[model samples]
Target: MQRYLEGELGEEQFRPLRLQNGLYIQRKAPMLRIAVPYGLLSSQQLRKLASLTRDYDKGYAHVSTRQNFQLNWPELERVPDLLGELAEVDMHCIQTSGNCIRNTTTDQFAGVSPDEVVDPRPYCELIRQWSTLHPEFAFLPRKFKIAVCGSQSDRAAIYSHDIGLALQHDRQGNLGVQVLVGGGLGRTPVIGSEIESWLDIKHLLSYLEAVLRVYNQLGRRDNKYKARIKILVRAMGVDKFREAVHREWSKLKDGDNTLTEKRIEDVRAHFRAMPYEQLDATAEAALLAQHDDPIFKNWLKRNTRGHKVAGYRAVTVALKHRDLAPGDITADQLDHLAELADRFSFSEARTTHHQNMVLADVRERDLHDLWTALQKANLATANAGYLTDMICCPGGDFCSLANAKSIPVSDAIRDRFDDLDYLYDLGPIELNISGCMNACGHHHIGHIGILGVDKKGKEFFQVSLGGRQAESPKIGKILGPSFGASEIPEVIAKILERYVELRQEDELFIDTIHRVGIEPFKERVYG
Candidate 1:
């Protein structure tokens, strides 16, 4: 780093080195992405991140759709120091960029979700250890991403990853994984195909190794645009791809890379259950009945989710407050959030792929108190899984790759739909906005997807409908031609109005789209 900063290293030589450290030269300045391994962070680590942001860059950070925190506006020369500070808390940026294995993501409610089949953190950690600095995969066709989901709901958006792992139990009661491959989103969005119905947990590492080896060998190298594993898998066809993987697996299965019971147990030990209190399961209901403040009640209902443990709930600290850009948190908020985590959630927090923070083990009795604290900090937006709680990218404002700005579009939508009662009436809707086709905001999977486009060097926005992120994930269909940025909010309003006119009782936006089609939406928006 010193050699590069001192001009001893050329741009070509320093490019990969800096990218491997998660440093990207953006439009405004250098951005540093700090990995929050599987979205987990200790309160101390949060505090450390806060301090780093204050000292190195602007006094704010953005939580990316991948569940990593990005510090924009950091000086190129000071990035090494920023990373050094991150190391104080056992965090690093290694492999966060470059054509290598990036951070493996999973359900934010991994251990606490009532619907979870197993805790996936152990396996995520295992993959992290194996992939970090692996010589063979250091330079793949392009960046590789993996997602694991232990729940039936598929909250991690597993279908949109290069490799998706779903945990399941066989008829004989043995734990195993169902593997999906070739899933990705960008210029070409392809839903992952099931490559393996079931594989014993013992062969997890060996099987993954075989898959990576196959991709490393056969994935495209000439055209960067068509280099992702998704393209290779698509070109080869699913059956042929599966056969190739099996042939490769036959050579490596049950070898030294095979996982052992003891090894799994060792990794599992690191994620032992949180120390929880034994309180009545009905305590939350009792408390809610007594609370007359409708605002607090609404926040409680919207932001908190069911937990596996009795008297405990997973609380989402919304970063999508209209006052700030989506997914952004101030340094002061980070410090206060650290304190909140310590007070309510055992000094640990998890970042969600939705760009929010999760306090996974809040006591039911302390619900009102936590809400009060969060509200005061402007962190309690009471809009989880709503239209205003949109997923957006830092577009032309920060990213050089962007063709148009994204934050303003998100702001306009949020401002246009500021009524809480109206949003609640509309029900759960995912509005994801991406600056360009890279789909960093995961626009491809949103129920209402917005992509920024360039029309003869001028900014424009394109809208899509019916996309969803869940067990039966589907890519949204583009509604029509692009519209001016100023025209977006009205366009969306018309689309929603058409849905209200056409929807069945209690039907979701995506369901309405599926019931009819994008034609209805296109007619409404264009008309």
Candidate 2:
């Protein structure tokens, strides 16, 4: 795969082809990311991923925030062979790297989420085909990501994605999408500005083409760091960029770029809803009895969410435990998850943007048994939406791009806020940590954002306030001076302490911050 993407080797190659793709080799090994198109994988395909990790790489698979899989491995030369095997299963790493389009991500729960007015799988598939090895986009300055979220809840973390598409229904009940462009994390993480209010589903592809066309034509080429679509959007202003897109789209809207009925149907055929079984009442009662136990109950409450389908649930396995690298899992863990999926839960698992894993369709009756098995493996963490369940990136410790090491800070914060009750009481507070300005950790969208910076060879973290990640998105405002790693936990604790003191009952952290401004919390945290 590396050789193919690099144009270094072809199908009939030599020994020089036996090289790693520079995919971050660690003491743990090289992490190879597999692009899963549209977040949709059949049970058999998912099982193959589990088997691949179990056999060649580590024993677990890390589901990326981008709806792809990353296997931590050591053998670089084996990548091509591994990729070759993946190809047999109808998968490829074609656009997974380089300046081309990265993975096309969509809401993890797009089709199943009842709150969605329409399924976005078709649109995602269309974009996936159009962008795969797209000649014009292959040499863009930096990586690109596109996400579609049809659900009312922003499961895709649309605000932080490079190109965010929210499927919306017009007053006439016509399906369209609200397009947001240029928002990104990584250095200079910024929330994307909206370019189109409502675009008909038919013009979706053409509209996207128009936006990319404008970006491709005008985006900065001198600096790799400043070349993202966000920079272009920011420079031109959303109105001006929209106008440019409108002018370009006018030429292409009714042309071949438009989504055709046949094309839509062909893509839709691949994304047909999975066959589900009727809810089992006995199983539900039994699981409820088992969950009556305190620990099991806690796991159920924290890690499990209600599924639209009866007798099933969306189970999150939190990877936010202290001392464990956030988003890192072993190949053995992947095998176990696959086995669990095959036996007790649905024959499937999901990866969330929050750096967590999900057993998407666990039978209610098997919840306790599943939890028990997971607990044995240290995989069952009851902190999914809590303060401890932080979204973090592989900061300076791994990435050459990082300004500071974020893992240590995350560990320190988790250690200080280990109390489950306190976390539950706080309710859905997001503490996003990014190692650098790239904002891969989505510092801009966190309720309490932490961005790492390098100042005179020392690490400092900048705190931002009032960022929210739901339907109405808002970027965070920077607080005062950056704090050292050691001071982060205390600063975060003090800030939360103020929120507790000032907030009304059931008011979320973001709401309170918005209402009170950062003064009270700033004084408390900095004092």
- Give lDDT for model 1: 0.92
Candidate whose TM-score is highest = 1
User: All candidates' lDDT scores?
Assistant: 0.92, 0.78
Residue 313 shift from truth in candidate 2, angstroms:
1.8
In candidate 2 the C-alpha lDDT for residue 32 amounts to: 68
Per-residue C-alpha lDDT of model 2 across residues 1-527, encoded as one tens digit per residue: 56555777774452222211225444445656787777656556777786787777756666666767777663766776777788877876566656667787776666666677778878888898888767777667667788888888887767776789999999999888999898887667777778777988889888888888888888888999889888888999889988999999889999987887888888889767667788776778675875567878888888887777777777887777764678877656666676777776557666667877777777787788898888877899898877888888878776677889998998888888888888989988888888888787888888889999999999999999988877577888888999999999988888888998999989988899989999898788766
lDDT of 1 by residue, 438-519 (tens): 9998999999999999989999998999898884799999898999999999999999899899999999888988989989
Please provide TM-scores, in order, for all candidate models, with all chains considered together: 0.99, 0.90
Judged by whole-model lDDT over C-alpha atoms, candidate 2 comes out at 0.78
